[model samples]
Target: MPQFDSDPVFCSLLQGSSDSRGSFSIDMMDYSHSEQSYIRNSPVLVTVLHDKYGNSAQITDFAPRFKQYGRVFCPVMTIRQIKPLNGSPRICVRLRPIYEYGAAIPQITHGSNHVRYVGPDMILRLTTNYSINAILDEIPVVLDEGVTLILGPDETVPDSVTEVGQQFLNQTLDYWHDWTRSLAIPYEWQQEVIRAAITLKLNAFEDTGAIIAAMTTSIPESPDSGRNWDYRYCWLRDGYFVVSTLNRLGTTQTMEKYIRYLINISANSENNFLWPVYRINGMRNMEEQIVESLAGYRSMGPVRVGNQAAEQIQNDVYGDAILATAHVFFDERLEKPGDEVLFRILENLGEKAIEVYDKPDAGPWEFRATKRVHTYSSVMCWAACDRLARIAHHLGLDNRYEYWNSQAKDMHKLIYERSWNEKLNSFVGSFDGNELDASLLLLNELDFLEKNDPKFASTVDAIGEHLKEGNFLFRYIAKDDFGEPEYAFTICTFWYIDALTSLGRKQEARELFEELLSCANHLGLMSEHINPEDREMWGNYPQTYSMVGIINSAIRLSTSWSDAL
Candidate 1:
């Protein structure tokens, strides 16, 4: 690792392993909540240093978790001795903290088993059973299984760290295993579905019920592609799919939490327009920027931290936000049922949709260079009004239902008339355009069109012919400022599976779906993009949308429970 001590902090998983080291990232002013990867680097490090013979011990590191306490998640690293002899073994610890997105390295002081590091951004405390001098000096001292370290905002260090750590590790596993038991996983692909659900669950900020898009930033969509973006913030469009998948798997808790988040955003909006993305804490501003100090993943320059797209008008958000809350309006289990207040707020969004449905926008694909009246955005706008009409009907608000339904119908007519291209034999990407966009694959999904509709079949074929590269799919094949897309967007491929299943092309869909599953990492985790050629996973990791696709496709295609045996 390049030990440039200034603008960035270098980190590693194994305490003493230099080759395994990586750099830290944060949501710079431009890339809001950018460092969605791992939590900040630990100011406390512990490693075993062995003398000449090179015989030493090993330490296991993990955050203390499982049973949910009100506010206690102490990361504990347990060091244990292995079978070793003929050498003087020692352990080394270090405390170097770069805070404020690598702009500041904090001042440190120690007391007993604790070290306090204070910076302008935040305060951190390291609690361990080692000497402060040894930690700062980077000298490895001999250690054993009982050694332990925990870091947190609070300075309180428990008396018996080893005992408490062991207890935490045991209970945490039991807690997770027990929770996993409650999943309503499909008989087939049960393990895969459960794992995806667990990952998605981790993505939710329980404090606010906000589900982030992913947990990393500045990892390029492709090598040196300049498509590196912060996936930490929550986007209403992506969150809608995530909520639907969770709700389908009988995990209504996340949906319930996300619905409340939706209501809160709507209540606070100055205009009826809903932002496509927001910080998990519900703070609205997300100005994106690039961090100059840190060399990016693989030392790629121009690592970005924030996401500026939060300000851009992506019209699909209104529909998604409304659809996100549709569950509570019908599910009697809700504590506070949807009322006229919510309907009125939705109507405000519906009006905004009608006003902007025909206007140009950044659209769901978030094209950076130019705006277009994307067919997908218009269809989603139609969905917003259409769902509002359904909710209004459910609430017995007949007038509201008629009003929203009329608006939805008009938008529907406008969309088909302008988007369909006779010559291309498919619905184009935008009004009066001839480009095929995979997002149009969502037509049947949004119920804008039925699978049996000849038009739907033709459009699917058109996208398959042009936008697909082997089994994987692209958002669109067109070139942009960065150049043509280098890999397949994994979620679009899932959308294709949904369409094929709906069309009763189960064999084709299953083959492709199986291939997609095989593309996941060894742990069955997926990201936003896939290198279709090499079948390597790329983009931000633990992608909620991609996992949502897995859960949804499995549900749509899994066999009867008897086969699970």
Candidate 2:
């Protein structure tokens, strides 16, 4: 995506607060939003200590879901206290909510028990289990921990905070444990697979099944790189892989939601033409803009909202869109199982692919200053045709199948002639040059080349030799708009591991996969890139692509059920 900023704005929402530790007001925006501001009553946690001898410890304060029930089903936050060796502690709580994307702070009317936050758009009723006087008047009490605090209209709460917190934690633990048990995970590398699965599930907007590229935006790809681009939208290219991965895990819920989104966009687009990205709700018109109101992550300037890549022409989406939809035709359980109608709609995208795949447009990297027929983009175009043919054959449309198959064969032949670099003895990144891109490593995964093919093996070696930096891989070492990428692209590194395992380098691949898994944040989450030199996460948080890579690699490399058992 180009780093430009000029577009209409749709505001994003969140709630933030301030406390004694510096100021949560301006502090946590470290890599979060800075442009928008709001104020409302949110929960506050104050740990008050009542000493054994009436010498109470000083209370320190600070603070912090999906909609489900008739009332908002917000997150059930839990506070756990490890048994303190020293002081007896009590808990104090408060509630505040922000209004209008942080632009306007809400007014609070303190009540005997609850507080009603008067916001510009809507009214919020915040209920508390503690004494309103203690919360509002700064009174403190020592309480136990591990209690799950549920904030609803009229619910009973425990006097011992620990009891509630622990119950909440227990329920949450059991909830996720049950969910994971439903997953078709490999017996081996179970932990790594589960972590990746959790991340992937989190990345999807459950309400709409739209999988976002990452949670936070403007996290620099490299330190002070100014390459902060917002990735809070659905990219067809990314969505394709997300659907495929979820399908591999036997989870079709997201696939159905996402395709409904895709179909909406397809029908709305002019003549099946598509932008690379769209908002989760299938909003097509995104105006990229700068949020000067908030400081950028780590003080990087010009924090941006709305991605400009949505405007770029990334042709690989044709294959992506089709591949994502292929399941619809075959899956009987889906609401609108694939029919002639959907196939016709998808054909328009395939036709658009054939029209543009050979033409010059933004490739997957979306390099504006330079454009070329990216090998990956072309292969996806080929993939679109290939998948359409398969779907047609499956549906008993003999003529359509024959036509798509023939077209796919022709496109494949042309790509081989153009993208294959005889001199390098491997496929190159773009038709115009010889730069080795890690994306070319996807050749086997895409089935463009057979797994055992000598050509595919050579490409793996070519990309590995050139792109590997210790255990991580860069998208490409060649510099672009901002200059050479200083960090390793986390997804690409995982892709490298997948490539290694595919080429029969199981031991080496396994070692690298373990290293990549180690690079995740404490929560087993990963950002877009990594500072390979220091193993620090860079770019956006909990990137879907990186998490998908982890899942796919583990599944590919895990031992057979018999062996694992």
CA lDDT of 44 in candidate 2? Answer: 22
Weakest ten-residue segment in model 1 by summed lDDT: 26-35
Candidate 1's residue-wise lDDT over 1-565, tens digit each?
Answer: 0111112233322112223323221101111111112111211122333344454443444444554565434342322212222243444455566654555667887887777777774566767666667665666555533455565564475567656656765665565566566677887788788778878887887667889898777777888888888888899998899888887787787898898888888888888768888888776766788876456666654566678788787888888887888877888866788888878877888888888888888888898778989998898889989999999999998998999899999999999999999999899999999889999888998999999999999999999999899889999989876889999999999999999999999889989999999998756789999988898888888788899999999988899687757
In the range 56-136, model 2's lDDT, one tens digit per residue, is: 332222211222354223242323222222344444443434433234555767665555556565554434445556544
lDDT of 1 at 22: 31
Q: What TM-score, to 2 decimals, does candidate 2 have?
A: 0.82
Q: Give the TM-score of candidate 1.
A: 0.86
For model 2, the local distance difference test gives 0.70
How close to the true structure is residue 298 of candidate 1, measured as C-alpha lDDT? 69
- The runs of at least 3 residues in candidate 2 whose Cα sits more than 4 Å from the true structure, single-residue gaps closed, are 1-87, 90-103, 117-119, 122-125, 131-141, 144-175, 331-336
Q: Tell me, what's the RMSD of every candidate?
A: 7.0, 7.3
Name the regions of candidate 1 deviating beyond 4 angstroms: 1-61, 64-96, 130-134, 141-143, 562-565
